[model samples]
Each structure stands twice: as C-alpha cells, then as structure tokens.
Target: MKRTTLSIALLSTVMLLTGCGEESNQTSNTATTQSVEKEPAQKACYDVGETTSFERKDVTGPRCQWRSEHNFIVYSEDLSKPEYPGTLPVKPGYAVRRAKEWPREDLSDASSYDKPRIQFWWNNVSSRDPLVNDYENGYKIWSVKIDGTDLRLVTDDMPSTASPQTFMMSRSPNNRYVAYAYSYGEPLIKAIFDLKTQQTIQLGSARTKPYLVWADDSSYIYFSDGFKRYKYTLATGIKEEVDVPLSENTVIVDGKLINAAGLGVGVYDAKTLKRLYTILPEKEFEDSVDIEKRIYRQIAISPNGKYVWGINSYRKVLINVEDKTWLAFSKEGDEKKVYDKVVNISNNGRETQVGAAIITIKHYGSDYRYELTGKGRQSWKVIQSGQNTITPVLYNADANDGRFLEIENDE
Candidate 1:
C-alpha cells in the first residue's frame, strides 16, 4: 500500500512540475509565452565562504569565535529582543549565575541537544544585530566545545555582496544541515549549508516569503510560502503543496502539521495532506468581552503538543486540543472563579493552581487595591507583580500545597 501511494504521489508531482514554470510567471507574461521560460532547479544548499580558523582575539568583540560539537539551543532573554542580535546559548546543565552582563561576543547562534554538551553561535560584538554588517567586513563562523573550551572561528571567506536583510538561520533536526533565508525585498531565497562538507546550495527563488520548519532528518523540509504549505523533498527535489495553508508559526508533531489559522487550530496529516481535526476558538469567552478591543498573541507550544499556550487580552490561557476547553487566568473577579495572571496545570491535568498580581485601580476618584482573601489554608497567592509585567513562574497542586515560586518582572 505504501508503494502504491508513493507511485500516485510521483505521478501527481510530475504533472505539477510540468506547469510550475507557466504558473510561476503568470503575472509577468501569458501562459503560452511563459512556458518557454524555465524555472531554475532548486540547489541543495547555499554557500557563503570556506571554513577557516581564527582565534578569539582577532575579532572586534571580547571572545568573538565559537562553535559547538553538539547541537545547541537558542533562546532570547528579553521578550522584546529584536529579530536579530539575540544570542543563542548552549544550555549548560549547570546554571551560570553571574551579574547581568553582555553575552559572549563570539557565540552568536546555537542549536539544542538533549544531553552532554550543546553548541552555540556568538557575535563579535554585543549588538543585537550581528549579521547586519557581516557582508561588509566579512563574517566568521566559530565552533565552541561543551566545556566552554576550544572556541575557534571556522569560515572560508565572506561573500562579496552585503548581507541580505532578514537573514534567518536554523539548524536541521539532525544537526547535519543549517538552513538560512536571504531576503531580497519582495522575493526571498533559501539555502541550506551542509556542515559536514562545508558547502552551500540555494533552494531556488521562493514563490513567497519562505519560513522553514523541518519535518525530520531525512525525507522532507516543510516551509510555507505565505499562503500555501509545501514539503520539499531533499532526495527527489520535488515540492508538493499541501491542502492546508499555514500561519507564520507552525508546530510539527507525531508527523503532523499543527497551526492556528482562521477561527481555529488545524491538525494536518503531513503525508496525505489532510486535516485530521480542527479546534475552533471558544466563542463564549470572546463574546463575554469585546474581542475587537483585545489583542491575542500565541507564545509557546508544549513538547507534547497537547496544549496551546497564549496570551489574550493581557491574560494567559491554556487551550486543550482534545476537549476544546479554554482555561483562562485573569485578575478581575471572585476567589472561587477569578484568577490573576499566572496559572499552572500538572502534566496529568489533575492538579491546578492560579496566581495573580495585586493591582491598584482608581475608580470614582478613589484608589482601590484588590488583594486575594483566604490566604493561610486556601487558594492562590501573589507570586510576582509589578507595574509593567507580572509573571508567575510556578504553581502548586493545591492552594496551600505549594507556595507561589517567583514572579518575574519584564521591565
């Protein structure tokens, strides 16, 4: 059955390929005339330069060269951290607690691994935008070891052209390949850099702005070209358009594509191109308040893909995919029903706790500060709070089961 399915897919791909050239140029010229103009084949990767060696002292910033033998995890410290210049640090098991200072200059980008030592990328300077000037004076790639030793630069030579705007880079799941996008105004180009061979291949001109999400190590790469979701096979060089149109943020789970698009979230089958299920947004909550006046933003997805975590109307919510149930944490009501800004649920969904920050409200020319009652043996506590941002980092199984851990302020 798998072989038969494969045969049908191949046949369908051939038909699509026959019309791609005409389809790509439909706006520029008529289909008949455009048929003669062929679209270039996708290259396997993109090349910037050869890998060379450089010491940390040679770069402008303090300790500018770094590389990691293991896959490294990249995260941003500030939520408002700009699109670039955010440092990707190797998640060391032991925490390095020090006075707040600039991140290492040499390690700019990094990948995540499960165990042992992970790898990270560094910039020569502490600027938020590292690659903005890489093409001007040339940029270097460095490798850092797990123990924070053997930091060295490795890149052949820099490109002649200025670094393209919106240069985004991500390592493949297997850590064998690094993919990046070179934004050229309207049309964006994607390229994959082979870490083992030190070579690059351009994926060809993207139809729309391309954002990449990898499926796995071997078969296919999932990338969205604005409106449509496509899977480009590295082995066959074939691109297949899926039925589902993906949003900017997409999550791959159990070989499925899950994304929030238009009224609900969709679970799509990557192989067969079918939507298995859709979880519509809860209208009850939206109708309770004027949704038009609120701003909704998605933050993170759980590793298991069972919950969708997001902030709506400055309040955090956890939406369960299985039941389509909405759990909200807010600071506006009674103890039994109302909550502040922080809420946590156990993995089994059995235990839950809600935390909130105390806020002062001025009404009728009077300043009123609301606080939680039933402090000793009952529910909820003010874990963390401030004027700007309130973050409840941890919650216990019961009201008094565990104390609110900490509240982080984002000012």
Candidate 2:
C-alpha cells in the first residue's frame, strides 16, 4: 500500500492536541503519567494485498506501514574531490539511509581529513536474482571515501531479511567498531565488528531486535532486548547484565542517555543507569491533553554532544545538555520553529572567534538551513533546496561549500 503523507501543520495540530508538551527550561524530579492514544482506525496501516486500486476512502488501513525501504544514493562534499557534487556514484545496488557520521576536517592531519570515509549499509544481491529486487536478499556494511576510492567491506554477516527496516547498525564514536543486528519479526542475532582487528564478536541474539548504543568514550556498548539491558565492555571482552537507561528510542551523549519516557523525557547517567532528572511538558500540554503521542520517539545529538533534540510525529524539543535548558516547538507555528537536525560548525568567518562554534539547524523538508548561536537564530544559506531526505556531508555553516547525500524513494 502507498504511504500516507500529512502536511506538517496539520500533523502538528493533531500532535499538540493529543500529545504532551515541553517548553521553557523547567524539569521535574520524576516522570509523570500520561495516557497515549493511537490514531483513529481510519489512519492506521493495513495491507491492501494485490488490490492496489482501492483508495483510503474505501479502506480503513494503516496510517503508516511497517517499512518503506528505498534506494539510497551516496553524495559527499570534499574540496579535494570535485567529482562528487550531487550524488556519488557508488557501485552498490542499494544503500542504507543511515549514513554514519563523517569525521570533521582534522587540521592536525590534513592528509586523513582530506580523504574522509563514510560507512553505510549496501545490498550484496546475488547475480542470479533480479538487480532491483526487494530487500529479502543480502546486505553488507561497506565504506568509501568522499572521492569514491578505498571502497572496502565493513562486514558481510548481515542476515538475509525480507525486512531491511528491522536491521540496525551503529558505528562507534572512535570509528573503530560497528554494532549491528538483524531484528526481523523476532530477534535473530547481534554482534560487534572490530574494524582494526577485523574480528566479529557476537553479543548473542535477542528475543526482539535489541537497541544498540555506544558510550561517549567508546568504552562500552549498551543494548536492551525489551526485557533486560546488557553492557558489553570492549577491552575486557566481557558481556555483563546491567541496568542502563537504554531504550528503543534513546541516544547517549556525553555519558548521558536522553530517554523518551512516555509523555515526558528523562536524562540518565549512561554508566550508572541512574536518572539524573525528568523533563515534563509544560502545564499547558500536561493538563490540557492526557493522551500521548510517543513524545521524542526520535533523537538527534550534535557531534559535540552539547545539544540533543527529540522529535515525535510533529512536536520537537531541543535540550542544551550542559545548561540543562530546553526549548520546545512544533510545526503549528504557535511556538519556535521546529528543526529536524542540529550540528556544530566552526565559525570560520570570524577569525578572531575561530574557536567559537555555530549550531546549524537543518529543517525537516530540507528546504532551509538556519544557524543558532548564543545571540539567536538566523537564516543560513544552503545550495540544495526543494529536495527531501538530503543528508549533509562535510556540511559547512557558511553555506559556501558542502556535500549532501540525497535519498530518493524508488517506487
């Protein structure tokens, strides 16, 4: 069945009415209870099977489907590689949308920085099968430089699955190891791959596809299989059962886990798994609507780890990790404008303030870019506009030069 698309404003209005809200800089000592309601049956996802002619008016199907796997084209920005302006022509048949973070330009070692590498998932389909077949085939982790040289396979252990959407892969911060899993309908397998050692350490299978997160220091890996949490230490080669603030929808930054706890949000010590504080919606959302919308279902953390943002269907909250302050916004225009991503960039324009960092905000539709600094938010010009699912590569805050990898859904 075709996926349904809702306007951002309409979706935000629905979310604001049925979901919790967070604003200002206040936080709570504990989490509050808020019941969440599912969208009306008319908006739910359901299989239309071979009958593709029927429209939504005649069917009460799902608002969304289980997965919407699509082809991903690679793109990059490197002054050394002028060949890659829009899309980097990769040999892989299909690429995963989750492109691991590219390393910042290392002024110390200009050689390595000039040849930045990007790791992503690519399908290794068999020659016998149709080249453009569905995902129920094979996948392998691979990496290539911005100029398309040094193409190497990260791993080939990914299981053949009908549902590539269920697979999860995470690259460590230090760029040494990759934690990957094939969840499928049930938990199948999970493991860690050492890029240097070229060794695969199986972390054991999960009853469900487990969530994988790496510590800020790259010392340990935390994962939860819905029932219990486990921490895997890298140096000791030890896997121990431990309680962590890990959840299906949590991101760890600066040794802290930003957890989406029902209608509210929580910050916890990633190492100790102890709750540091709880962020609750303002009185307006908490008392106004008791229903939930799975607040903060998605999280994006800045490279510097100083800022993190949580996004639900339409509402989003940006939190300043160091100050413990936050700002809430939605697409409805009642609050601050919602931004989908936040990244740190050096303010090169001001040579005296070279050390100063500028926060770049990429809007949801990839239509506009904005820079948020201590003063306020302002427009940041960018070349790639009117395109959706555009991931920045070597993203420059000045808007003078940058590379964007665009993912177009192939129907």
Candidate 3:
C-alpha cells in the first residue's frame, strides 16, 4: 500500500512541472506579440499623389487646403538654385541711402549707418501730419553712398498734387537687387531697381501691396498679386503662378517659405510651392475665459522666426514654434507677471525688441498713463510721438533708450 501511495505522489509532481512549462511558454508568446505592436512604422520621404494641404502634427483634421488651380506651383528649395551662376564678385564699398539736404556728418550719426542706403520720403521732424504735409512739400526718394559721402535724389519728378505712398523696402535674398513699392493713385506700382545696372523696371498695377521676395539675388523674384503668388525670372522673363497662396509676413527658411496664414501657419517648398505642413493654433486656449473675453489685436513674428508675439485687447501672449505652447503677459497694478496661457509648456520664452508697430490703443480719461514694463528689456526709444483727434495718442518707446517719446500738443 505504501509503495502505491509513493508512486501516485511522484506522478502528481511530474504533471505539475509539465503544467508550469506550458504557462511559461504562453507568457513568452504574449510578450513577443506586445513587442511587435510597440514598434513604430517607418515613414516615407515623399508621398505620391498627395494633395497640397496644411496639417498640424499636434492637431487633428485637414486644417487648411490649397488648390493647384489657383496658379499655385510648389518649388522644392532643394531643387531651386541661385540665379547668379558663378562666384559672386565682392564689392569694395557698402551701399547707403540718405536725404540730399542732410549733411554727410549727420548721416554718420544716423542709426542705420552700416546698412546699404536706399531713399524714402521722410519728414525731418516727427510731426502729427508728417506723411500728409511732408511728402506734398517736395520729398522724394534718395540714395546715399555707404561711406556717407554721396547723396543723390533717385526720382527727379516730385508729385505736386498728392503724397507718394511708400509701402515697403527689401533687398533680394541673394543681395542682387533692391525693390520698393509705391502707390501713385488707385493702382499700386512696384519697381525692381537693379543696383548693378542702375536701371529700374516698373511692374505696374498690383491689386494690393506688391511684396517683392527673392529666392536668390539673380535668379527669381516672388510676389503676391492679392489673388495669387507669382515668381518672375529676370533672365527668362518666365512668370509662373504657385500652387498655394503665400502667407502674410512670410520668410524663406530651410528652403521653405513659411507663412502666417489665417487658419494657422504653413510651410511651403519655396521652389515647387508644395505645402509641407500647416501648424494649427492650440485648441485649449479657445475655451479660456480671458482669451474669449478680450479681442486679439495684432500678431508679430519674431525676427529669428522662433516665437510669435501676439497682443490682444486685454493682454499679450508669446507662442513657441516647435511645441505649439503659449505664455501670456499679465499686468496687475505695479507688478507685472507672465503666466502659462496654454498647458503642457513651461513659461520660459524671453522677450525681444520688435521692430515694427504692431498695434496702438488709446485711453481718454484722467487716469491716462503709458507705462512700459517687462522682465528683462525696456521699451524701445521713441522715434516720434504726437496726439491729435485723427491720430492715436503717440507714446513711442525705444528698446535701446529708456526714455519715452512723448508728444504733447503745442496748441
């Protein structure tokens, strides 16, 4: 009886060991399945037959779409080469622009002494009606030598009737040419002035302001004609419509023209005009109590193309480019603070001096006061300031100088 009992116990132990081996095998097979599922799929460089659209990697849905029918062609920056084929010849002296009446000594004191000079009709003094009165009193475009030696009036004919409306000035990306836009009357005119030959080609009648952008110095010129964006070749006289509407306040970077569009921001191939991706606005802030209560006034793109500075009716916000994160500038009494407006981002973006005037607000009361307060940098020194019924109370502040450019009525 004892022998039979011992044999039964041994058989039971063998069965238990066999069951444990099967369980171990099942766990190993389950782990292998999970490891295969966790691996990410490889992505292709280029997708075939893909429609041009902007897709924010952080957001869902087709946020923005571009039609090829709208004279939109996408150029790959990789494929687009410089216009001037050979090595660019170095010029000895720098280019400069100054007023003819201004002394060469005074020109040296101007802030833009180092930059190549191009002339614009500007008032000698900051006034309430600088544009209206100054241009009518015989102000014309001028060019100044870089060394502050020569100053010559570019346009011989000064308008006797109305002020010449100067819109914008830009040097070509390749530094081959200089372009400016001016409005004579109803129709706007753009002139591409060739510095090499000292000749000007008047490209007439644009719907809105003509934005002259360059892919390179000698090869191509990009402009938006209100309806569409066009690239004109100086050598071949070939003008082609691109595949997407170029965004406002766009800059060429990494072979792509990134634009600030209505929906969000988009990146397009500067050569092929193909839309790469659209960065969508953060949705979390859409439902915020503060943002919803106040009206958003202006948005400024940083010079370095890293952050976006936006001013609302109530407050200011800074947005990060890479992470789609935002921080709002808040002011309470004499103390100023910056808080995270959007989630998932640390409040670490720094403020810099913005060149252009983004927006202006007016307050009319006994408590009316303009105060410039930020963490690190102060306001820019005011170039000019004045107050009138027509003009908003001008309080110009410069980042370099800590003084206010305050204008009080002599009346």
Candidate 4:
C-alpha cells in the first residue's frame, strides 16, 4: 500500500529492458495486441555491468534469502542513496505516503538454482485514489540478485487501460520457471516466466479465486479458481479444465495436493486427482474440536512440497507428505495466542529446516519466540531467545538458523 525509494547495490551499467523512469514511459509495449497463440523469442538475461555501492534507505525492510545463500532487502527510508549521483534503485516513497494501516511487502525467493534471483512486486500507487499513480498503469514485477545486481523488470507490455495488479507467484520445482497471476481489469493475467531466458508467456485467465502450482519439470502450469483446476501444457499450449474439487484451504504440491477439508487431511495425486491418503485429527483433540466444521486457513507448504502446515482461527495442523502422516495441535486452555507466521523455508526445498514464530501478548509486553523445525530423516527444533517483544517475529532460518544476519544494530 505504501511506496518507497529502493536502494539496490551494483547497478552502474544495468540495462533497462522495460523502464519506468520518465513520466511518459507508461505506454504499453505490445501488451495489448499480443496474441496468446504466438510465442515470443526467449530473452537473454539482463546484461549487467560493474558492481557499484549505494547509500539509500536508512531503515531496512524485510530481508529474504536467495537460494538460501544470500540476502535481499525491500527497505524504505526518508533519504535516497545514489551510487553515481543519479543512479537510484527506484523512486523514494514520499514521507507523506505513510499511512497508519497498509499492507507490507510479502517477498518470496523466486530464484532458480541455476541462476540466483529473487522476485518481488512494486506498487507505485500510494492510494486507491486514481490520481496517486496513474490509475491506468504503474504496478510491475521485478527480479534481482541477492548481491543487488542485474535488476531486471518483468510484467512489461501491460495494457494501458487495464491495470495489471494483485500478483501471486509460484516457482517451479525445477527452479527454471515461475508461474504467477495478476488481474488486468477483467478476466485475469495468468502467466509464466522462464527465468533463464527472461521470457513470459500468457496462457489464460481465471474467473473465480485463482491459485497456482507448477509441475516438477516445469512442463505444466496448474491453477484453480475454486470451482475447477486447469492444467496448461507448455509444449502444446492447450489449457483444459480438469475435474479437481478445491476449497479455500487446499494447495497443490508437485505430484500431490494437501487439503484440510472434512474432519481430516486429504492427500491426492495431482496428475490423476486420486486420493492417496487421509489423516484425521488425534482422538484427544477430536472431542473438543469438530474437524468437519472447522475452517482451516493460512496454509503454508514447504518449498519441496514435502511438509504442509495449516491453521484455522484457533487450531494448527502439520502434515508430512512423504509418509502420509499429520499432527493437529494447539495451545492448551486459556493460553494467549497473539500471532504465528511461517518465516524461512528450505533453500533447496528439502525438509531439513523451516522457520516460524509463535507469539503471546502480555500486559507488559509481547513474547516473540522463533522456531527452526526440521523434518525428514533429520528432525529437531533449534529455538531463539524470546525474552521480550523486541525480538523480530521472523527469522532467516538458513542451514545455521542465522540469528545475527537480520538483527538490528542498537549500537
């Protein structure tokens, strides 16, 4: 909801594939007349020049791990940090743009293992008012490295009258492709990008609530708009709706899907849409809670599609996909449950480690406890000190469960 000046390092000679510098650069670039049947030439990755230093925002935003090896931040501050006096990452957000309530940036590691990169969105619009950002245009998708070089712009060619907004991304298991969705006024902008070539293809649109899942080989892109699931074959360009029933709390893994409907957790074959396994909540908790009537939301699946975590307003469920096992547990009687969130996922999409935060708000202060849970052959939990509310709710859980990397320097 808020816009800010982004300070990225190493962009002295970065080529602008689709620039948004000048006020008039909002013109749609072949996005309107483009036909879905035609395939564009694969674009070589943005040609980046020498590395440069920057001194932009003083306050850093959330930091994301790229390939679980490097860090990228979406910071915002009052000052602008320039490398060569004029080179800036993006225009700075006006101090007046700050609002009491607005959505913060939600970034995902959209990097391909072969070519390290991270994906995030830019909302130039500061308000719902048409005048804030040209209501006709402005929103965009971007990718950069953990080292802050090779800043490439995706989501060009947006129709001038059509606003390409509300983007959700799902990187393929192979890490070569990212399939995402955005609505252009009507229908939907369901597209996939080949990170290597920097080329994106629009397959089709969705009418209802749309969720995306990519095939392991990057050969197919699947999306469900609540009613039915559709599979679009990359080679054939054929998009056919499949007979898949979906609720709001379901997510598709590579070859399987995890759904928390009825009174149990259901696993299905993604290809054949066949039920593979079902896990009911433990009998001890079943007496107090009605799984059949409970609505599970905020479901988070690990990058490898091996572990599934789901939560209703009050309860939580953890599912081990490989073994078809699950656990449904919640805090005991009258316990204060302030917040919970999934922080860091595995870099290589394994069950090695996943990070999360469990919080309890007290009269004096809030308690922030971080957890790094291990799944698969190795299983353990390394915890962070949760003495006070000052503890950051999110932890960048790498192989080390790095603590200092994101900690602010009080000195």
Candidate 5:
C-alpha cells in the first residue's frame, strides 16, 4: 500500500491542540483512558504463503551447542553481496497501493533489516530498470514500513553502468544514511544516501574491498579499503586516515567494532579502539573437536547486550555475560542435518530499542521462537505453526518471496 508520505518536518513536528480552558485532573484521566482504549493495536505480520513455520529445538539449560537435530535456522545477509541475480516482478512498476488497513499482499522477495521496522531491497522489474539482464542500467531501492505502510522509493536509480557492482550495503545506526560500494574505476566507488535529504552522494572511492562503518554520532564514518582505515564526515565531506590496522570485514554494530574470526567474536570500543570483550570458544567443545575442523560462523551479539550467539554448523552456543554461562542444547558433537539457518533476536515491536529478546530461528522452511527465561535460560516454544510465516512486522523486500540466504556447507 502507498504511504502517507509526509515531509520530515511534518512527521517530526508534534501537533498540540489548544482549548479555551484546561480540563480537570479527573476528566483528563477519563479522556486518556478512552483514547488509550480506542487506539488501534500495532500491525501484525500474516503469512504470504511463500514462507512456512517449522520446528524449534528446546536445547537449553547447562550444556552448550545443540550438535544434533536440535539445531534451528539462522537468517542472515552478507553485506558484501548486496545484489543477487533473480527474477524481476511481472508487473515491474506496478506497486499495490493500500490504506493503513492492509490485506496480505504478496511480499515475495522482500528482505528486512535487523530492526525490521523498515525493509529495503533492489527491484529488478521496476519501471526504473526496464531492461532485461540490464542490471547495470539502473535499479530502485524500494522501502516500506513493517506494517506495509509508507511504501516509497528510498534511492533514485542506482546505475550499474556507473557502479559495476553495488556491494557492502548497509544502513546507518541512526538510519540517517545508507551506504554502499560500487565500481567507478580503479578505485571503489562508495556512496551514501541521506534519508533526511533524500539525496545520494559519492563520498569518494576506495582501493580496498570497501568495508564501511558509521559512527554512533552519524556525523562520521570509518571504512577500510584493504588494510588502510579512513574516516569520512558527512557534514563536512572531509576524509581523514586513521592509523588502525583493520580489515575489509570489520563491521560497526551498535557503535562497536565487531571482528568475527577464528578466535570467536571480538567487541571493541570504537572510539578508544580498545578491546572491550573477547568471547573465546567454549573450552569443553574445543577439547572434544578439532578447532580447524569444527565450524563457528554467524557470530552475533544481542542488541540489548544480554546475549552473544556463536552459531556453528554443528553446534550453537548462547552466552550471557553477566553469569558467564555458555548455554546450548542437551546434546553435543556430531554430523547434524544440512542446516540452513539464521537466528535473529528482536523485541515485541519492530522498532523498539529495549524489550525482551524475541529469539527467532528459521530452518527447514519454517520458523521457531524461543525466549530467554528470567534466570537467563533458554525457553523453547513454537510461537507459530504451519508454513513460512514472518514476524508480521517484516515486509519482505526481496524478489524471491521470503527466501533466506543460508548455506549449510561448513568449511
């Protein structure tokens, strides 16, 4: 459905109603109760039929890493590979327009950000990109609210002709700037899209693989071309070199420099560049299996700073820093099934910053939800049953209706 695209000023400005006189405290309370009762509930996600609901493994308590059929799916996207070759929309520019109340429109290939409040993905059959296999011609970045409202184009035509590839794409923590890398020439073209200004600018080019990180302030960004680290300010258009020996895969999550490697996950203080946390591999598991042989991938920290997950091909470990507990399933060690998985932690609302971590795992054409018990234990339960259903708030923004990017090949 189409969004009521109000300007930033209009949306940000709070409307204050004036009256002849103020109401009494009791009357105000009554009015407030009525307003609260009458307000509409937050939108919920419904099945697009393309996705399904699967099983959830209840492997929680003392042990760690569910090394058997208890493994759940983990949904994640690689920023390095932004555009994947896929089928275009049949109608191309035809977007379904709807009011605030919506029907289950086909959100086939839609992909959502970690936040899930908004979704952004490239549209191949868009009116902007009318050519076939002419991916380089131009494409549009379509965005919509989680409730399927406020559907609008976030970026103008991103021409592949100018940028042979638009890789390493990410939205800023503030959601103020959207950055990506493209091939302009010998140097890699790195561009930023200002959501407020609705303008896209080529900050400059890099010689490296083009890994970018936005500062918490959103005023500056740090990126690595290869081994060289540089910072660019959005307001001043100034780029400065930082003498930090960082690599291309370095990412800034919640303002921390996250380095996920063979050593496990390392969370660093982005400003002082000090190591804040060095999450090592579980020693018990390390002793049982070969470090080089066992796979440890998709290392992510909960946004609430409560849990850290080391999603392995065979085993998965959940860590709570306060208690120093490495929790997982009941079983351990062995060749599990072909695990196509990506686990995400979210809140009740798509845009809420603080709340219980709604731990979701997608595997085998279905989804399962688990909760962290009050004692910091994992409480596994089937939140939804049936086909591939999403967390009602996520509007699929990709071409392949709700298809996730996960490969079980642990190498």
Candidate 6:
C-alpha cells in the first residue's frame, strides 16, 4: 500500500508562483549546500542586508501590518500595507511586479500568522518576461517578514534555467524550515531550507514538482517524486519511503474526506466512504462557454470540515459543506450565492465559539466588514470603514490559526 502522489492540477490550471522586482543593492553570499549524496557544486550566493527594511512610518494608502485585535480574515494588502510603499513598489525592490493582464507577484507562499513571512524567487536582474527571463542568471530564494524588517536569503543556488512560475514552497508550522521545489528545465528538484542556519538540504530530484506538506508538530515532511512518497525527518536527516494515499485536491479532517474535482467537490466519511455533501460552482458563464473554464481548483477544507474554499477559472470561492451552498464573489448575483454579501461565518458546535470569519464587503457604495459565528449572518460590523483593494497573487493557509491569507479584490 504505497502512498502515491496525487496528480493535483490545481496550480497548473492557474499559473502560480511568478515574481517580479526592479533592482536593489544585491549582495553576494555563498550558500552552504548539503546533499544526501554528492554535494552540489559550490556557486555564488545572494544575501539581503540586515539593515534592509521596507517598514514605512506613514502608511496612508493601505495597511500591511498585522493587527493584534483585528478580525479573523486577514488580507494580503493589509499585511503588506505597513511595509510596501505602493501596490507595486519597484524602487527598493521586493514588491510585486505587475503585468498588463494581472498584477504579477511571486504568488508563492505568503504567511498569515502573527510573524508572517513571504518567500519568492529573485534574479538581481531587472527584466519582466512572462516567466523567468532568459538573460537572468542570479536566481535565488529570499524571504522577508510582512513588515519588511527581517530580510534573509534562503538560498542562491536555484538553477538559472528554473522557471519561476514552477517554484512552489511551504513553510513549516514551527517556521524553522522552508520546503520548496521547482523544475530546472525538465524534471523537478526539491529541497529544504533551514531558516535558523540559513542553509539548504537538497533532497533527491522528482519527476514532477512534488508538493511539500509538514506534519503538525513539524517533525517530518511529506512529498512525492511523482512515483514514490517520502517522509524526511528534520532532526535525524533520515528520508524514509512511505505508503500514504492522498489526493492533492482533497483533505481529511475529523474522519471526513473532502475532495474537489472538476466542476464540483464532495465530502464523504472516510470510514464509510459515503458522500455527505456535494458542492458545485455557481452558473456564472453562459451555457455555450467551455465547461473547463468552470472547473474548480485549489480546494481547501476548514480544520473542522465544516467549510471549503477554492478558486476556479474566474474568481475565488467558498462553500458550506452542511448547506451544500457554493459561493462566488460576484458584482451581480443572488444574495445567497454572492460571497461578497457574506459578512462572516464560523462554526464551533461543541465549544462556546468554534471559529470566527469575516469578509471585507462593499454595500451601498461604501465599505463594510462583518464576523459570523455560525449562528447566521450577523449585522454588519464596521471594524474598518474604508479599505483599499490590492491584487493578491498568493495565499497561504495556516489551518491551525483557523484563518487564511487574502488580498483585496482588484475589481
């Protein structure tokens, strides 16, 4: 019973993990590479100075700093507000580079926790191609806190030919390590970066870019090279083969298996394998439109298995497993179907409050915010009266925190 890596096309459907920046004072540092077998050839490394900080004193546009007493729903714009001078700051670099179609940022893994950090690929060169520029060479991984204070170089040994869009990363719950993978030209390669030591441990290559998932305690990491699954122990440096069948587009919580495929998703009891709820996307496009455009991807289930969220060809979405209601962010749609109208919703049946959620909304030509506690849609609570919408390129979900990272809608 070998656990095979599920071929989840969530990222493929939507182009994920692209980065852009102007030019900054690039410092060169040698990266310490540790390989399981023969060590990789030593190469020049890149480093960000300890003095480099994007902290802004007067953040009049939008707020990017975390609020200790804020609502559950945290937006990327809000998180980047305190640090970023503008929506796309190209002066000091490290800000998202946008294209004419969409704001092009390294939509990789952006943290949502208290000390959230974001990781991305940067080449010290200032050129914006659709993917990685051909002339670029200094490909490296860099990370910084949301407030842009602690900037550190994760690794500078990324293959020059590696596609930036193919880059995928996940930070461990403990924030000690970052597991990342990307394709150089053909087959994919994966590795773990030590945040504390500022070094890298290169795992073997994978046929496909394997997904990185860390254990709750951050004891072990799970990934597949498209054929065999592996569990790498952080302390012992032991990589063991494992047989755990998992669907990339699904999650199991409280004995419930939630799977999102094609145009719909289903929730089933893991033991009985019986479906409990079937959620489908709203009918937004005309019937003559291609059905593939309506397919759902990046599906996520809440820790309690009560709710699910994802994105499709058009917009981000959400669903209540119990009610089987699929919600979409829309300008003109049904009151129940429009997630824009959803003030807040959270359910904790056993405890006094299981969870709480809020959505920044637009009502009657004004801004509003609300938090729902599973009792029903509550009254509009204006925690922040006027909020600006910044285009979000990446989202990282911290299941333990009961909240996911978000960016305001560009619309």
- For this target, which candidate reaches the highest lDDT against the unseen true structure? 2
Best by TM-score: 2
In order of listing, the candidates' clash counts read 31, 8, 27, 5, 25, 12
TM-score of each: 0.45, 0.52, 0.46, 0.50, 0.49, 0.45
Clashes of 6: 12
lDDT of 1 by residue, 1-411 (tens): 999999999999999997896777775677577689887742211111211223211221221212222112122123222221211222121111110121331323433221112222222321222222433233223333322223233332334232332323444555555555545445666666665576776665555666666664435666665566667777787888765555434556577777753344678786675888886554555767676534354343332345555555545455676676656655344422332222333222322233222211111101112222221112211111011112221211122222121112201
Q: lDDT scores for all predictions?
A: 0.40, 0.45, 0.41, 0.42, 0.42, 0.44
TM-score of structure candidate 5: 0.49
Worst 10 residues of 1 by lDDT: 359-368
What's every prediction's RMSD, in angstroms? 30.5, 28.1, 29.2, 22.4, 22.9, 26.4
Superposed Cα RMSD, model 4: 22.4
**Candidate 3: residue 184 lDDT (0-100):** 59
Residues 295-377 of candidate 5 have per-residue lDDT tens digits of 56554443333445555545665555434556553224332211223333232111111111122222221111232112112
Local distance difference test, candidate 1: 0.40
Model 6 RMSD in Å is: 26.4
Per-residue CA lDDT of candidate 2, range 232-258, in tens? Answer: 899998888886665444556666777
Q: What would the TM-score be for candidate 4 when compared with the true structure?
A: 0.50
Write model 3 residue lDDT over 23-86, tens digit each, in one string. Answer: 9999999999888885453222221112232431221123111222111112112211243221
